[model samples]
Target: MVGALIIALGILSAGWLLLKALSRGQTADFTAIRLALARYLALALEFQLGADILSTAISPTWEQLGKLGAIAIIRTALNYFLSREMRDERGQTSAEKPVVERAD
Candidate 1:
């Protein structure tokens, strides 16, 4: 129940942020928005994985174990890609910024 709530909250928050960004019209930085959504989704996935683990702990059936394993693998892959994308985005943003040289 808690996990579902967390996931819902994450989705709602991401949608709100996206809508807010869209309302900004031409001045909105989409890269930043994407980063924010990715972060929220990653967090939500973590909570979901935790919930699955808890469920498996309570009942150790073969079917349940297989389901958990598949879920874990999928979530882990998603998380890994999300994190990599976030890192790349951060690096790209930083690189795009103009660095001012200090005058002696």
Candidate 2:
């Protein structure tokens, strides 16, 4: 159900990244590509985390609860790093943008 959807989204994201890379060739902006992929990964992880929570809510089994907790922690860690990297990339991108001087 939700798990299958999550897997499908992940696969789609990977395929998109591959296609983007191939289309761009050597002129690819790796930072932008990384940011885009990271965004997709983060979104997919959030959906996965939500699904885990829902599963535990419906079952309340100790095994399910344990699995949910572990999965939540892992997803949180991945999202934290992905967000940090995105922030760094955005900062670098902004800094690299050309500044134009206004002539009065």
Candidate 3:
């Protein structure tokens, strides 16, 4: 309960900071905040999934764990890739980032 609350608060605060920075035309700062928020969101997912693994009445424990690990890895990578795309959209990257947003 407490962990979830903390994660929620962190997400909100980071998102607020990102929006505020973007509104100020600080693209660099906004990108930084956006990355930070992504990290926090990943952590929250990891924590929640971990708790679910332990507490939830799920079947096939080992298989579930393996799938969870894969999911976490994929999700984290997706977030990073999306961040790169966003930065590219903002003209931060040297190469042109993909215009379409698709999960890897």
TM-score, candidate number 3? 0.44
Clashing pairs in 3: none
lDDT of 1: 0.84
Ranking by TM-score: 1, 2, 3
> Candidate 3, which segments miss by more than 4 Å at Cα?
19-24, 27-29, 57-104
Q: Over the stretch 7-103, how does candidate 1's per-residue lDDT look in tens digits?
A: 6776787678778867776344678767876787788789889989998999689999999999999999999999999999999999998999999
Of 2 and 3, the candidate ranking higher by TM-score: 2
lDDT of each structure? Answer: 0.84, 0.79, 0.65
Best by TM-score: 1
TM-score per candidate: 0.79, 0.76, 0.44
Residue-level lDDT of model 3, residues 5-36, one tens digit each, is 75687788887887787788887545556556
**What lDDT is reached at residue 27 by model 2?**
52
Clashes of each: 0, 0, 0
